[model samples]
Target: MTTQATLTPAKELAAKNRARFPNESAEYRQARNALLAEEIELRRHIERVAERRRQLPPGGEVTKDYRFEGENGPVALADLFGDKDTLIIYSYMFGPEREKPCPMCTSLMASWEGKVPDIEQRVALAMVARSPIERLVAAKKARGWRQLKVYSDSDGSFTRDYVSADDADVPAYTVFTRRDGTIRHFWSAEMSSEMADPGQDPRDAPDPDPLWTLLDTTPEGRGANWYPKLEYPSAG
Candidate 1:
């Protein structure tokens, strides 16, 4: 039978203390250096994977010319591309059932908001939802997001078309390119559990989520695998 962990008062007290490792022996030092080299090599491999993304062939056909509300009003699908050579459409999963914006999505977009100027210089980035324009705008305001250009697909067809919001497909980060009045898909990323690790770091920047930074303080140490969850409604 599986046993559930029970924390006695003493156990809980012990958990509050930081873990300390013993001094290493000469053999341990040699093994540690070799392991450090392996870690560096693994990071280099991840960098190479990121590099391959830039080399992907650009040509994902837009199956439908979906309309979306722009700052002025209704705008053609192509207008969303702005003036950039590449367009990144993030399919956000905030729907009627969600009740509130997703904290995980919020965390990712928070980083995007700060990079808008730099991103717009080379690529068009937009957050897409299947909700009404007003609803999407309201949620954006609630989240204090100013940098992301929001769009509403109301009909789930856009989500289905891009494989971005299906239960089977997790939130996707996809890049597309336009040529001769045609849009083509370039790259898509959806990391699987096998690819994730205890030390996995997704963001390339030094600045990380303050939420995670704070959570790293406790004994759980971010609890093996974790993602941000909405707190106002006390995450289901």
Candidate 2:
């Protein structure tokens, strides 16, 4: 792969002298164009990665009887699948002490809740956590996440097996498939980085976190790297 120099000195100077500071020059134009090209290529790479992830093999039979609850009442892991061929579970980070949802996880979950109908059409979705089921449920209610299928993984091992344990841990989005009364593992995405860019292969960063994106628009600039307390303005 050819590495494009998107951070030439010229680009730096131009960025420092943008519309907010307005000092147009030929060098700046060249640098800007180069940066734009690089960005376009990066986006294309991200699209390819998404496609590749979609094609990954669903391994392991996971028909184990894991039980939990939802708005619809008592549910098993299999029930979450909703007769679909695939099951997608998300390991949320809302712990017992969370007076509010983790900003990043909340952002992702809130978005998922919005996309639930569409996401459900393609894959069964659920947010799992080790917190007590009631605690998790209350947090979800407070967040107004009515559509999301929130569940408790209080046993802890379920999360350990999937590799999402602790606050700093990355939320894991795992996919599974059911066949012959058994479930198989499929695709999984782990967010190890604190600040992720949604751009392409983020082996170095988490995807541009939607929460950060939303918060960044405000003058706070994501507020000294601190997140929004689930209780909101009152939490501080």
Candidate 3:
């Protein structure tokens, strides 16, 4: 059996895949075949990028022993890792100045809440916010996020240093690694609106949020006017 490294070209593999619907037109089938070719290339590119990311050299070592308020009490950056050497921190946009959390961030976190147990098996995961611990807890409860461990960056040290320098009401995904008693920054999502293509939203390739992915399969394709909301007024 040929492994992926020795497999046929993506286009060839894509062309070999055949499917037909009851009443689909010939033109539709032809267009779909072309789309499938591109999809196969996209999948290959994603794997290549992931391989490069894993090969990256060590990132900058963390200097500040940032403190955070967890559910139980105060905890340091090192403590968040527990027994795991890697930690993935998601900066929640629920800062003190904001009356409510960012809807986009909330939407992503809601999906992550269900995957926490599976995700934590390899690396530690924590959701950090600039709000006080109590406020963070309240928001978590309100959203019914039971699995995600929430923490408060009460001093804004970690947020400012790793997330944003100005404490912007923005969400960020960052990863850190610990080795030989030294913790170092690993990687973070740096894609921004400035990097977006014309007519496309600035988002990471193969977005972490499953919402957009699921929508991409539909006819509307993640409609521009629609967005996830914290709550929708119930129909009276």
Q: How high is the lDDT of residue 12 in model 2? A: 46
- Against the reference, the lDDT scores of all candidates come to 0.68, 0.67, 0.90
Identify the leading candidate in terms of lDDT: 3
Report the poorest 10 consecutive residues by lDDT, candidate 1. 1-10
Which segments of candidate 2 are over 4 A away from where they belong?
1-25, 96-100, 164-170, 179-181, 190-208, 212-224, 231-236
Select the stronger candidate by lDDT from 2 and 3: 3
Clashes of each: 4, 12, 0
How do the residues 1-236 of candidate 2 rate in per-residue lDDT, one tens digit apiece?
A: 22353434434444554442267687867666677566655665776677766667757776566776565566777888887888888887765556655676777677667878997787788888766778877877777777887887665656766755444345677888887777778766655554555542233222434665566457666544355444455665
**What's the best-to-worst order under lDDT?**
3, 1, 2
Please give the distance, in angstroms, between residue 15's alpha carbon in candidate 2 and its true position after superposition.
Answer: 20
Stretches off by above 4 angstroms in model 3 are 1-4
TM-score of 3: 0.94
What does the lDDT read for residue 83 in candidate 2? 72
In the range 144-230, model 3's lDDT, one tens digit per residue, is: 888899999998888888889998868889999999999999999999989999988789876999999999999989987888999
Q: What are the clashing pairs of model 1?
A: 59-184, 59-185, 60-184, 60-185
TM-score of each: 0.68, 0.68, 0.94
lDDT tens digits by residue: candidate 1, 73-172: 8876678887876788887777656777677777878767888899899888888776677888888887787888988766667677675446332455
